[model samples]
Target: MVKEQKKRFVLDTNVLLHEPLAIYSFKEHDVVIPMTVLEELDQIKDRKKDVSRDARVAIRTLENCVGDAPPDLLLQGVPLNHPNAPDESLGKLAIFPDHQVTFANPVNLPGDNNDNRIINAALYLQQQSSEQIVLVTKDINMRLKAKGAGLEKVEDYRTDQLVDDIQFLAKGFCELEGDIWSQVSKVSSEKVGRDTYHTLMRNELEEESFYQNQFVIDQGDDFCAQVKSVNDRQLVLKDLSRDRLMSYHAWGIHPKNIYQGMAMQALMDPEIDMVILTGPAGSGKTLLSLAAALEQVVEQRLYDKVIVTRNTPEIAESIGFLPGTEEEKMAPWLAAVTDTLEVLHKQDESPAGSLQYIMDKANIQFKSINFMRGRSIQNAFVLLDECQNLTPSQLKTIITRMGEGTKLVCSGNLAQIDSTYLTAVTSGLTYIVERFKEFDGSANVYLNGVVRSRLAKFAEQEL
Candidate 1:
């Protein structure tokens, strides 16, 4: 009988950072770590920076799981490669004896980079063993290089799948049932006060029925106190603040644009402590969020200040070392923020002083991700722009900074993530939407059509 051969797999540096447990992912199969890959891991692990902290943690976790190695030998297994090696030199290392393991240094690779060396090592393994060899990495360019070099079996270490639950709620409408009204009323008037009524109105419920208002509700009972509504094309907010209602109409936003209308409703919702907006490039997520925030600070006087921030993960190349003050360093990325603010200012018919006066009184502040740590924001309208660049952990950090009576508005394009480790499904914006859908204090809106231009919408669909 011919024995079944075990497949051999080699991992690149990114694959390990993405999923350190990948070594154990393949059951009873041999895993190879090229010398160059180890060198790359060592460099990342040695970095003394905040950004590399997570990478260091990953390395430590992997090392803890798979013991230490010998001083002289580059590779070690469950059974020592050399039994006669000194006990002090041969540190404890986990090696699988049932699997045949070997290391190779490929002499001739097109490039001397770590990625190329990994590919070459996999090729060498394939040539030496009867079993198939698979190369695993999270780098898109490296995967392409592997394929171009005639390595057919390459796989992405799918850490991106961990956050897939977020994508399911990206474009869906949540239902608030009929019986939640009574339960809400049972809470103290302060707890379920005017904000509760505002939530109901924004949900587009019938003004007549006590429970018919379309809003988020927290009910103590499972069956009797439930919130339910069918997903509809148009979202209507009946009793919004006058300023917000006027601003929405002025911006040419209405039920005619269903998705934008829904997003507007969420933005206008006073009861919701958190709102998440996700869409593509031309969806007007930023403009709508800015408009709503302006209305609250300028007219309603509900919050003490308006705080705007963004995660500026570079789109392609770095913008280079910016030369300026803190605000100047942020100016380029914040042009869109200022543009929206200017539009709102332009709509004001009063003298020029009115816009400046409002800005001064409301304490409007623009911030970047660099200054967010260790700050507690209170009674403020906080806008997290371009949140798609944030990881789930990073988003959690930002959200936890919200203080009492503060409302957080997060907007992003799920399809346009700029972070090295994040994608549509794995971004913090999508993460919040999925986890908070059932929470009464949270609302999500997905804007579909582009409001930028007719040509832009056409380009979005066709190109």
Candidate 2:
């Protein structure tokens, strides 16, 4: 019996930008980087943006793969090692067009487009190679063009996707069994302001293996508590319904919806180092995160300053030559940031001209994602809004920047991704919610309610 030939994968540029180590994802299969894609990466490598940074890293990784290897290896292949895609002998990575192969562009696409060139390279490989050849890209249009050009083997890279289906993603809460409430009341014994809590038997639901800081809410009744701590035969439960956090207003704002209420509880808990709020437009994801951040920074003095950053939309390929510095370039993009602050001020009922002082007192400063690569943030509250557009790799970069005594809130509407490549199931918010499900001090909420205004709610539901 003859053994089957290994498959070949030709990766698109966006896939590399989204995950710098994507070459290793093709297990036991050959990986190909079109020379055109390399040139595109080189064109944007100097920009101060996450995608550009990823492009440079990928270029370096490719170079390292070629280090000390004979010139023939560039056309043949080099071994790759990645823990996530571990198969030591799985496959090899190489640069496509080690010798030029002739191919034509899709008639509808411009000949000068980089995407068409990449697709043409894939076409050459498909015609020349006996093994299966696939074009892996995140761009929907690129996929369409590849298919139209008769390249049947094309797919989006799924290595970073945590879940296969959108419905399979956790909604950040679980329904509690009826008897557990009584069991909860038995071990109940803690108070914070007007709130009451309990510590249930850890073994009571040990088989379920509930995640830390997970909300156990029952719409049928008022029994709501978070898994405060999980130890042998004893699990600490903190009340969510009767907690003082729900009734407390933050910077003259209160949680108007149940989802917002849960978000506030997680934010106010010092034990929780990270909180994620996922919701649609007008669902108050930004407003709730802002209120919680201000309350912690100004009222509780939990942090010295609030660092607010508006991550660039994924559409930008490079930062280019803006006339001003980082902050000045980022200022125009921070309209949403300032608008949220104004709403918080008006909610506070502050007199005219008091809003500016409130903002200065809170010590809010805008930080651009361009310069956030190597900084450590301590004793501060960081808000990354519009995070749905961020790739999983970019999100990881920001999360690693958190230092001691720092809390980060990632707010986004997963349904409204602006990036041409990202989908609801493949977004960074989705990745974090699923990847951190079992980790302690990390909580997430799915806010489906729209409570901003009647008109806004109507648009959200009808439009």
Provide the lowest-lDDT 10-residue window in model 2.
314-323
Q: Where does candidate 1 clash, by residue pair?
A: 77-95, 78-95, 176-227, 176-228, 177-227, 177-228, 203-214
Q: Candidate 1 local accuracy as lDDT? A: 0.62
Q: What is the TM-score of each candidate against the true structure?
A: 0.64, 0.85
Tens digit of per-residue lDDT, candidate 1, span 1-463: 9855666677777666545445655545566666676566778775543345446655665565455455333244442122232242222223222122233543435654667767777776676667787888878888898888768699876543545455455353433446545423232221244432222332344422221223322222232111332233222223333233234542333433545655676677688799888777878888887777777876788888988888775521333366766666677887888777676667677736665686687777877665787899899999999888777667777899999989999988876776786666656677677677667677777776888888988988898
List RMSD in Å for every model shown.
10.0, 4.3
Q: Point to the candidate with the largest TM-score.
A: 2
In angstroms, give how far residue 321 of model 1 lies from its true place.
4.6
> In candidate 2, what are the lDDT values of residues 1-463, reduced to their tens digit?
9877789999998888888888877778989998888988998798645567888988987887767777688778777766554546668887876236554543333457788888877877777778899999999888998999888799998999999998877777776555455544356588979766787776655246667888877644466777767767787777766344458577778877667778887878788899988887888878888888888888889998988886666324434455576555666777787777777766456644666786688888778776687999999999988888888988998999999999999888887888767899889889999988788868988887899789988998888
State the lDDT at 385 in candidate 2.
87
Best lDDT among the predictions, by candidate number = 2
Clashes of 2: 5
Whole-model Cα lDDT of every candidate shown, in order? 0.62, 0.79
